[model samples]
Each structure stands twice: as C-alpha cells, then as structure tokens.
Target: MTTTPDDLAALLASVESDERDLVLSTFTHDDAWRLGCLLVELADERDLPVTIDVRKGPQQVFHAAREGTTPDNDSWVQRKVRVVERFGASSYLVGLRARAKGTTFADQHQLPLQEYAAHGGAFPVRVEGVGIVGVVTVSGLAQGDDHALVTEALRSFLGR
Candidate 1:
C-alpha cells in the first residue's frame, strides 16, 4: 500500500462503478420501510423487539425501529458493531449456532451455525463479500422465529 495521492485515486478508480451502484442501490430502495414493517409484524406476534440497520463496517447509515417500550436503535447498532468487531468472520457462525435445532442445510444432515442470529437477528440482510454492510436484528423472540422473520424479509428484497 502506497501513500501517494495518485495511488489512492487509481485504487478508487479500479473499483467498478456498476458494482458500487448495485450495492448502493440495494440499500436506497424504498423497501427498507416495508421490510421494517415485516420485522415489526413478526416481532409483535412473537412479542419480540426488531431493528433494521444498514451498516458499512462499524458505521451505520440507516436505522429503522419497530418495537421496544422506548427507542434504542443507536445503542442497538453499537451493540451489533461490537459483535461484528469482536466475532469477525465467526460472528455469523455464532449467529447460526444460536439457531433453534434440527435445521437442514449444505449437508444432507447437518447443524446450522446460529439459528437465533444474535449478531443481526432473525433474517440476514448482509451482502456477501461486503462483511455485514447491513443487518436486520430481533430480540424477545425464539431464535428460530427471529431467524425466520429476518431472513424472510431479506428474501423479499433480495429475491427481487
């Protein structure tokens, strides 16, 4: 890595414009609110708390709240950032570990990493190779339900 201004500029230019837009556009969608609604519905039904946060490493750009007697998206995102920083690549592994049980996956008969998804909760809104640039988290619900809710919402937007 060089400190030259030209080097930095060249590195920045090396990044594909379309890739940047694809990642950027994924978050800017009006669907974040809709996804928030889905998380809320699941949370209310399960009597759990839900939070949708758009992250760029340790930084959060957008956060939507669904429940809790009080608003605490700020603290929650911080908590998530801490989780990511602490767990690194293993965070998602731990989240899959929190999974309920008897879930099927890559192997014919295998265990999930974390069913509850504690680091992010419920479903995953993360972008692969982006290192958790976004998250949808839930609490007060069973790990299974929590994972289902968040992942379902992710499926909706990620599907389209």
Candidate 2:
C-alpha cells in the first residue's frame, strides 16, 4: 500500500504516542513471559504466522514461533531487535523517522543490513523510570501488520 505523507505523519505520531504511553511500572523476566504469551495469543487468534521474541537486555527471556513461521522470521526478529537496542525506539518508528527525513534507514544510519533492520515488529520495552529495558519483536507478517500486532498486544497487556 502506498503511504501518503499524511499517512506517514499520522503513523509516526501514533508510534511516538505508544512509546510515551505504554510505559510499564517495571519489567521483569516474568513480565516478558507474560507479554510474550499475550503476543502469541493475539496472533494465534487471528491465525497469523509469526515468530515472537522478547528480550531483557542481552538475554532473551521469551520466544515463540507459530506453526507457519520459517527460520527467516527468526532472523527478522533479531534484526528488528537490533534496531530497538541501538535506537531505543520502536523499529517502525525508526523507519518512519528515516522516511520523514527522505532517506532509507540503513543509509541514514550507515548500518549494515545484516546487523540491523529499521522495520516494523520490534518495540522497546520501557519502564516508567528505567528507560528502555528490552525489546518485543514479531515477524512473518507484513511489516506494518507485525508492528500493529506487537503494539496491540502491548496495549492489551498493559491494560491500556
């Protein structure tokens, strides 16, 4: 689908709003597990083929792959996680910011494609005062769908 500048602006605003509003009081390994499970349930309910990953710092706390996912989905999750780790923003937000600046994410940041991806599906796990503690990522759908799935799960998990 073609994204008009207006659409991009609105999406960017929504992602920024999510980052600002979805702060957890605290995030723990248990919290990651709960969040990860929520994501899986949401995807499964919709019959989405996706791989989900939740990381606490450098340690992966939770992971799940739905039946239709391929190994490539895992790689996408990792790459999207790197984007969140490096930028402390949602992967979709990073990509939107790049587009807003009239550049591709890789070229704008000079990041290697194999190591980082500024695509949708990865979101920073932020605690109220602790900043970004980890990432929650999903892959296998269209990038925008992946992002929406994660955000929707976050909204549900956080009771937003």
Candidate 3:
C-alpha cells in the first residue's frame, strides 16, 4: 500500500522514540562499518540497486554497493543527510511533517532545495544522551522504500 502523509507521521512517531531509546553509548567506526555492512547485505538479498552510506558527522566510515545507481543517487544521499543533520530527525519524517503543515522543506525552512532534501533514507544516529552524532542513508529506490529499508536495518541492528 502507498503510504500517506498520516502514515508517515505515525511511522515517524513510532520509530523516533525507539531510536532515541536505542542509542549507543559510544558510536565508533566499527559500529558504522557493521551497520553499513548489514544494510548492504539486506539490500543485496532483495537485489536492490542502492547505495549505503554511514557517516559520523563529516566523516564517512562506510559507503558501498552502488549497483545500478548513479551519481544522482550519491547526490540524493548528501541532500537527505543534510535534512537529517539540520533537523535531527529522519528525512522522511521531516518531509511528512512539512507536507502536513502544507509547506515544503525549502519553503518552510528557507533552505536551498539543491542543498537539502526532505526525501527518505536518511536517519540520525543518536548517541544516547549525546544527541545526534551521524546519519545512515540509502538511495536509488522509492522514497518510502528507502526509508523503510534503513529503518528496518536500524531496528535489527539495535535489536529493537
């Protein structure tokens, strides 16, 4: 079924709290690598042509498996990451909220559309009480699919 804005909002509410509750005490490069590998493995099992990116602040620890993906997918990843970093929330959630408020992210936040994307597939890596530390992103699928894939991977990784 196609996800509506309300569905997206519900998803955001359900997952964001879990994400906050499941934060790592200390997120390391090894953690990023493992998470990235899990994302890639899951995507490959589904034969998805997606790029997986795991970043800690400005440092990208893992980026892999861009099968059937283009440079545009990389750009989408960066844009989605910008949205997550700016809002400290999942990119899809942000977009859904924007739509619910009857505005676009660029119009509502006055951010350049070229720089920030409110599309899916970018999730904040919240470090327990430390707040947002990084982002995990995937691209090259429908926006909701991208978000769902990352969310599912994170849930499995966090054992939530």
Cα error, candidate 2, residue 100 (Å): 0.7
lDDT of 2 by residue, 1-160 (tens): 7889999999899989988988889899999999999998888788998999999989999999999999989989989998998888999999999998888998899988998989899999988868999999999988889999988998998897
Model 3 Cα lDDT, one tens digit per residue, 1-160: 7768777678768656645655767789999999999999999889999999999888999998557998888899999999888788889888877777878777889988889999988988888768888899999899879988988888788877
Error of 1 at 69 (Å): 3.7
RMSD of every prediction: 14.9, 0.9, 2.1
lDDT of 1 by residue, 26-112 (tens): 453345556666666656676665565544444444466655624544454455444445444222334443332323222322333
Q: For model 2, what is the C-alpha lDDT against the true structure? A: 0.91
Specify the highest-TM-score model's number: 2
Taken over the whole model, the C-alpha lDDT of each candidate is 0.43, 0.91, 0.86
> Clashes per prediction?
16, 0, 0
Error of 2 at 124 (Å): 0.3
The reply for model 2, stretches above 4 Å from the true place, is none
Residue 125 lDDT, candidate 3, scale 0-100: 88
- For TM-score, candidate 1 versus 2, the one ahead is 2
CA RMSD (A), model 1: 14.9
Better of 1 and 3 by TM-score: 3
